[model samples]
Target chain A: MKQACSIPARAGIGLKPSHYRDALDSVGTIAWFEVHAENYMGAGGAPHVWLERLRSNFPFSLHGVGLSLGGAEALDQEHLANLRTLIDRYEPGLVSEHLAWCRRDGLFFNDLLPLPLNEESLDVVARHVEQTQEALGRRILVENPSSYFAFESSTLEEPEFLSELCERSGCGLLLDINNVYVSACNNDFDAETYLGKIKAEQVGEIHLAGHAVEHLEDGETLRIDDHGSHVCDAVWGLFEKFAGRCTGVPVLVEWDTNVPSLSVMLEEASKADRILTQVSSH
Target chain B: MQNGDGDTLGKIVGDDSKFSRRFSVYRNNVYHSLTVALSDAYPVVKRLVGDDFFLAMARTYLDGGGFPVHAPLYDFGKDFPDFITGFAPAESLPWLGDVGRIERAWLQAYHGADAESGGMNLEALSSGDAERISGLRLVFHPSLCIEQLSWGAFEVWEARGGEGVAGMKVEARKNFIVAARGMDGDVRVGSFGEGVFDFFERLHNGKGIMAAAGDMDVSVVGEVLGGLVRLGAVIGVEE
Candidate 1:
């Protein structure tokens, strides 16, 4: 069954170990925090200590990166159990995983691999999502991935695939606006049209992140979702447009690589908050 | 796409040259992320080998099908030490494998389970009968781990934050290191002499106080026990 989102409709930042002290100190100043579920899968230590302490003060969302929810193999039960334990302990306001696969034949590729958008793949993903929801005993949000290439064997579009998966699995969508923008640029698609096709009511959260623009050898510009710098202006524009329509959806600013100081992250969140405020006032 | 048959997968992504160029993006992302994970786990090892060498070494490691079998990245590089031991390129650096082991131990202790309260039961040591107290076994914390190496791996690990291994001498000698989460919830690593090492080794082997001490001096035993308690390594004492 679908669980109602509990996170406030404001700006949040991805909680990194480097920002623990700053995050703890600025509890009320920030809206909430999201963490990669796999990072804290350890039994106990500084990660858990900081998470336990900060969780007492602010809300959190467990964003998983290792579920391999779209893989052809059976689900990793051990990983799911660890996630369940973490959710029970942290009591996060929201939980989400990507609509991508990272494992195959018992080997984890350590990257969000692209999935073909077709009926067979859709059935596989829907079954995995349903199994995950049943295992966790709560509905989760499946995020769209930033792809570099499209599958020729695909019969449907990305939004249509996600919409059908959500319809079948009774899950929600975690709209990563930057991903939409990145995939749009790399795959030559209309970002606004992609956004228009998404069911806003099914969106439980919004993700904002930075991406790197790489000029290919063939004079082609490919957008890589690295999340290493500040959220680009193009992504911010998409987020603003999406936020205006999907008002009150929680927004999270994620910067994982070459992470800057806590102030820079807070500044990004503040920028998102400004857009959200300006949009809601309209 | 699931298998390594690139030709079949290449057909699926399309025959366009742009698609081929873009497909390498995913391959690069996977390799880059896995290398970063390894570099993070073995910072000292990476520093010792230098960035270029480390990158090449990690490339070889990944190409040799060293992908992690599990989803948790933290548990991915446990076999890296063993891999380094047999790695031909690193043959000149005989101590690199031990250094990797030490770093792995540090990471394990950092993420290990927390220790239970009431360590050592000092009252029991003070008031119990001498013979019974001497026979008491010590329960160590889950995070506590001892590494015995033939080279000065601990020295290299300690030098990670300083000037680094540049212009430094690495002595080939028997080394004993104890890594455990301290009372303050920080992973603490310390090198010790033979006496302290022997005592900890015996205790780690499930030996009691007197049995672990063997013929060692009583004063050194007391000192080692004090250090263990300080490190939060000794969780409980049982008869």
Candidate 2:
């Protein structure tokens, strides 16, 4: 089957269960919907059912949260197989996974934990990305994760590490602008300089979301990528900067919790659309 | 610790005291995350057995057994009912397993896709033959889950709060339950009798309505048949 979704330089909302019916009711002019692949990993259910219905109207992107792509040990083959099955079934417009690890010794944490950007870990991640792309027989996008702490053992910066992965594996980048803001704020880095270093051509898609702040030791603040509320001012400013460079990429608004009504989500999507339109028009 | 080859759990966890402590932290994280996922998936089950008891039961379940390899969070609790059966503390709560059955069925119904049930078509069949349609093969929607319980499982499952009930009560009788979703996305639970169960069994076995419910009480079976039709539980009836 042909890929069902394509990024037409437009904005789309992250699909949630609460808005499935209303989304189906009003999918017109709404660029596409993105979903967490793990949520639909079932034989048959409402997620799969509504996904099928929504796919008929709008193209979709499968943003995976599991897979532990950057683990110390070998990558999880079963997780790859599940991803393959979903890709084959859905034929999504875009397939993306985070550059993080959530498993060790066959035990999975089910959370997108951070990875140290080092030679050993980079090699492991590249091999897994190559195998995953080969398994799906398609180009996959690697998303930058929101990290709380930087490992002292790492040598390369996050942008350089991601750029190298794209170069070595021939995979695409999923530029999560919210993640960049969250990580930069937590680690005291300039988000704009970090975005400037990333190879723009390698980015296949972009993500924007809301984050929660947590206070840590020594007056340090950590911005958690909660994706449960409206788009913040700072993240939107950073997104506008990136959108200028990557003009045609599809931008998805991710809201995983405290999801509002369908119209409320649409309002968020409209905000993204306005930004993309303004950037492209210039 | 073995490196670059097959190893044991000790090799993975390590022999160092700090490594063991760190491993425990990671293990606790995984177990707690999965328990929260299960709690979300089975809220009714969590409510049935208060939060503390449920967490304690979940901790014991994890201690005894882990989830299936690489299964999604939604499909994590398929074996929970069976685990509840063998659990020492839950053994006295005989209805617990049955409640689990209901929870599992509810989960299935909640997630299963909408499909046209190829059973009896009430509109096509002559109105006069509807009552005589006993033993007609009954095909339920793919979402329908029926379970036969030893006691008042349906009641115990739907029961709320700390109600006082000691052993066998007035409702501790064998019951047949069906949970199915309708075309409009509304889910429902209903009960059936021996005749209806026999008919459903036959239909699920690919028999037509006439062939399945052929030997039952004509009038009582007719009532159940009309109810199924009104509920949109039956999609089509083969002649």
Candidate 3:
């Protein structure tokens, strides 16, 4: 009786507790939804209850932030088993995690920290991705992380590293356009070039979110991936470009902080839908 | 972003002169989100200490370096009560830590295991002789948690909206507070008399009827048994 519906390649929104009730009622235009797997790892409770009812109405994707897939140590067995339990219970249409590490050696930072883009770090991440896919018995899309600063030892570019990660592990890329633009501006790289280098066919999903331009004490600008506002014109433009390439991948609008009402979130989803529709028609 | 002079992040932004200033965005985000998570987990503590102090305290708690490895923030703050007891600033309001304990218990119960609350198989229960009732072992609902506190934390919780509790004097009496989620999918907190709470606590810990009921009034045993069953708190009882 507990299960999930299959999703289409349309716009979806990240599941937030504030919008769970409306999500259950139904947002007709939205094709599916995603949630952080860490939030649902509890033994049981209201989150599962609402999710159960909503799962029947909408397909779900288990996106994880705390699994530390890119952690240098061996893949965490307990976290893997917990994820397995969710996958079995929900049978989500897609499963995904970020291409970043938040934890290492039994310590967690509670944020998606960037990894070095070189041979050694690549191998560590690929092995972990392979282990996760094999354990879940499902292919997962790994989202590109939004980085404020890069590692000095990093050799390969972000897209080249991601392309190799996919080629080696068979995991698809969840291209977050905002992350592309933010990272590009912050680190002084060309966003279009970054998008061009990624193997288009390897992209299984796209993400669009709002970011804030924080002015530091010094007269300089830094783009923060806050997800507190609407998707900016710059990020949306980048998404339109990537949307032309990936063609039919589902695009998700993630609004974590300053979560507006369900109607506001749905409006964002509809905007993504418009872009996706235009791409499909073309 | 919390800014620092560390050159590591700056190396990533190779040509940038304002690396620390630029890197402050991520630093700020990480601290902001994690601090919000801490506040959500410890709302009563937030209410007691107010926003600025609570956020600052949450940061201090995070800097303690023992935040659970790989656990969701929902299951976070399990050690917060102990953390508060040792925090120097909070020493003036000692009961603040115990209030945190109750809040954590409430969250655990709210998110605890889901189970169908079963009534005692009356057919199995009634057929037993009167003497057999005293030896029966009982199972409490899966979400049940009873915390013994030496402060009027529940009184503070109950009086949340009636009036502000700023200058209220709370008596420190031995209290066994109950946190239980019913089948209707709501978690509620209440109090249990010392004897009754102990009897259930012992039974909850896997003790059999006679052993768990030690020192409880025999005359009131039937009353506690009936009340607990009517409340759907007992799942299975071995006679």
Candidate 4:
């Protein structure tokens, strides 16, 4: 059978409750929609109701911001169970999680945190991913995360590490282009070179979001991958590059905080759609 | 991994030197994030208490407790209202629990799923059968919530002031309030009386409309049924 989620190559918006009615009222040809799985973990209510309705009209990708899949400790079974419940209910076309850990031990940072690429940590993560995939009864897409710092204990490059994960876990990739751009700039690497090393066949989806440049205590600057604003010019350029390279992959426009109105978001989706069309037609 | 929770926390920081200091950074951040999630989930309570006190109280709450799981922090503060009562700084603040409850309910309402509209067509019922509709058992939405509070909890929530429920009493008395989301996406709370409660109790128990209404005044039954239908709480009717 095909993977659970199948977000189309066209542009889709992140699902927000404020736009629930507007989306239901006028879906308007948007190919797919994504929701933070954590947002709809409840047994019943408006989120479930709107999601059920919206799912009828469009394909959905359940993107999880929590789960801390790459954390040093054992994966939280309860979190995994909740994820399993959501997967069972929605049967989301695509389910993706970040290749980062937000919690250590029991304290959860509630952010997409960076991971130290070492053998022990890798073993832990691979085991967890395998277990999580098995529990959900489907392969999951692990997206590369944007990070402010890299640990000195790292052994493998990010792409090589991700490639290893795919090899071991038999999962797919939700290659987040903006994360690559932001992390490469922060860690002083070439975005194109970083993107060039990945296996495109495993890439099932793409994420395009905005970032902000923040000055650290040192003289250097760090690009914070805050999905609060519109897609920046550089990120857009990177997305266009990736789309050209990997056509027919679903593209998601994520704007989590400071979410704009539905019309504004749909406009952004249209812009991405136009470029996706250009990339594919070529 | 005997105590995976503690060991995992120790590993997250990854520094034995200045364990307290490094651990503090991770602990503080986690606490702040979870506390903020609580505050966000219960903004009305935050507004009720000033930002400063709310932050202090949140920190205190975190100092005493840890998240139950690695799930989204939404469930972390499900018992926060009860926790706040034991908070020393908040001793004088009795309605804080109610405020917290309201906030939790609001968060619940905000994220609650919309239901498919359902109701038996009232027009189909014959005049004689229509009268029996009042006695029919009614089904409540899965998200329907009824919270009872003392000291005008609803009024205080509606006011949204920083005075901190100044004159409100914190007695253990109950206030009957029904919380349900309307069809238009408006979440509302209203006073539910004994009559309303009994009517619902009967309807929810699968009692027929006429039988459910048998003990109640005919006019009161009609009014309650009409109100429930208008509230979108009663989705279907069967004779």
TM-score for each model: 0.94, 0.79, 0.91, 0.78
**Where does the lowest 10-residue lDDT sum fall in candidate 3 chain A?**
A1-10
For A29-135, candidate 1 gives per-residue lDDT tens digits of 87899999999899888998899998888888999999999887889999999999999888889999998888877789888988788999999999999999898
Error of 4 at B32 (Å): 6.0
RMSD of 1: 2.3
Per-model CA lDDT versus the true structure: 0.86, 0.74, 0.78, 0.73
Span of ten consecutive residues with least summed lDDT in model 2 chain B? B1-10
Go through the candidates in order and give the clash count of each: 0, 18, 2, 22
User: Which pairs of residues collide in candidate 1?
Assistant: none
What is candidate 3's CAPRI-style docking category based on DockQ? medium
Q: Candidate 3: where are CA atoms >4 Å away?
A: A1-5, B1-11, B15-17, B22-24, B122-136, B193-197, B206-211, B218-232, B236-239
Fraction of native contacts, model 1:
0.83
Cα lDDT over the full model 4: 0.73
Q: Write the per-residue lDDT of candidate 2 for residues A176-260, one digit (tens) a residue.
A: 9999998898667899999999888888889898988766444645577778789899999999888888877888888887888
On DockQ, who's better, 2 or 4?
A: 4
* A124-164: candidate 4 lDDT, tens digit per residue: 77887898898888888899988655565688888988888
Candidate 3 per-residue lDDT over residues A1-282, each given as its tens digit:
112326577888998998888787775755789998888888788989888888888877888887777677787788889999999998888888988877655766688877678898899999999999989888888999988777778998889888999999988898899999999988889998889888888888788899888776666678888888999998888888778868767778999988998788889989888988887788
Per-residue CA lDDT of model 1 for B1-239, tens digit only, reads: 32344453434555567666777888888889999999999999998888998888888887877889877887888888888888999998888988998898899999998876645665566564768768988887788877777787777788882576766677787877778887578787777765477778888888999999988887788778777777667767887
